[model samples]
Target: MTAHTATTLRSAGSTGISLPEAIRRADLGDAVALLASAKKYTVARLSGGRLSVPGKGSFADGAGVAGTSTERALPLSTSGPDAVFEARIFNKDAELRWLHEGDGLGTAVVLSESPDICRPLGEFLDPLYAVEQIDNRYLLWGRPLRSHDSGASTGPLSTGPLSTGPLWVRLAEARIGLLDVPVSRAPRENECVFLRTVEYVTTEPEHGNAYVAEERLVELFLAPPEQSKAAGSPQPDRLPEATR
Candidate 1:
């Protein structure tokens, strides 16, 4: 996408919001950021469910089940042929096991050093916002794209099998490194990754509705959960941030 086109999409409908900007502000230095409290990552998706305060338009729950989550990360790098690392972060509900229902959601985007990498995802950031279904991850945008990869317009990214495993990219660690550690397998929407720490976060909705705009109440403690025996402070300094 050209600079002109990039600017075009941001101005499309919703103010100047674009995926890159959202990722920029995600606080984690990734596409997503959770407000920190105590020793836990406050993982919140833009809730499809909204908390309607009488006259309020409908504010979606920004935070999900807090201390009950585990994070697996891999940094984004490698510029030459593969700048775009594509994959799906899939999870199902604790009780409801339906795919494409969007029970799973999250993205912590660490900005890459390459403009090439950011540009591709930029093309569809607007559509991502306009999408009616709040939880749907981008299978491909409805738009035809002329990608930098082939100079040919391709459809949305091939829907890789809902990652039964965790997330992406590569290079020798000489100057490259994986984000955190690639997750071995995806935790079911509400399963615990560690047997000892049963406080894994659930992507499942606090309430059931086919789409977002309904508010789901995720429980979060001012402190870590009683079940967590693991120890560490989720201090802001401990989390990664964009190079900028």
Candidate 2:
């Protein structure tokens, strides 16, 4: 009875030899499904259909291919959560190493032609330091030059006043011309603002293994406390300050 059953099974297997080819041929007709997985897998067009499977799944088993995909071609997702997490840990470790073993901060001398440009710097180091000029540069003194019920810091930057705040002052001194607005919320006129920002840009998954790197540029803007302002109430004769 066992021999008879084995013979029957062998016959069935022999007749089903064309089954794998038939399945592969049918799969090739649906090109969309194959292209959909292209981001996560190394998809290549075969003679009849496309090959779409996981890194571990064998093309030979599914598409009746001869060998597995190459190592460089298989891992399409090189920068996943795991890679990013590892990169963060690596950056932290590097910072800690620098803090422990790197040379500490050192003082440097920056000679300026005029003291007007460098005067507000003292206020950053010591908020109590008094600033003398406050006409257009009220924001540099860390006080609102003008305000409204809306509570917006400054009017729309384009039409807002030009105070020649710290950045503009420095840029003017250095003769640097910026044709475009550098900051997203660039301070208008007299505001002295400090901002720290990070931006990450990634390519589409169809591009295959992602390329990533951390690049940073630190630019600091410092200002002062209220300068040339005195405590006083407006008399009936005097007009109130303009709040645009």
Candidate 3:
């Protein structure tokens, strides 16, 4: 029999709290079971902007950073009667490593920053899985999409090799632009791939200088088409966020 270990899901706050305990106290095992039934996990914020899990841990300092507010600590929020959680996945190293959610299975949510998280989680979950790192170099075949303002046009931002450094300069000269979104290159067709949508927040009052608090709502999706589907045609998955 495959041994099933109870994965600990903790809360975010200055005082560390146990999410699983709270869930038990609130009698929310049914809700948690419902979430797990999807074969997917979700991260969301609860009262006091504290991170709540179906099982262990409570809302407390997620990253152990001093003076960070609860709002800044957890970015994902719950919705409706079921309190479905939501968050935006951005590109960040630390947040990706610590806060993002993933199943022990060979699947995980790809947050915004550092596409490396996909590989890292993949390796952590399935040692036998081969991870191939791909530079963010692709075309934005449609309009830009923003999490806050869906109507606002951020323009087609380039990703991959076209948005980086010396390569960026050459790509810019060649008509390519900076990359806005980064995507993974593995988990071919029919495979379930996890994609995280993290929303970053900061205790700092200034919008420009605040730091990223936490990542929430690690999402899952089907892997895109293979090279055969890329015969001079843009893959739908490769389209701009708006189009997607």
The candidate that achieves the highest TM-score relative to the unseen native structure: 3
Candidate 2 lDDT, tens digit per residue, 49-155? Answer: 33233234322222211122321121222233211110000010010000111121112111122233223222212111111111121111122222222234233
Runs in model 3 with CA error above 4 Å?
1-76, 81-88, 92-124, 128-131, 136-243
| Model 1 whole-model lDDT (C-alpha atoms) | 0.21
The top-ranked prediction according to lDDT is 3
By the lDDT metric, which is better: model 2 or model 3? 3
Give candidate 2 misplaced runs (Cα > 4 Å): 1-98, 102-161, 167-207, 218-244
Q: Could you tell me which 10 consecutive residues in candidate 3 have the lowest summed lDDT? A: 164-173
Error of 2 at 64 (Å): 74
lDDT of 3 at 226: 44
> Candidate 1, after superposition: displacement of residue 147 in Å?
42
Angstrom error of the Cα, residue 42, model 1: value is: 1.6
Q: What TM-score does prediction 2 earn?
A: 0.16
Per-candidate clashes come to 21, 1, 39
User: What are the Cα lDDT values of the candidates?
Assistant: 0.21, 0.21, 0.26
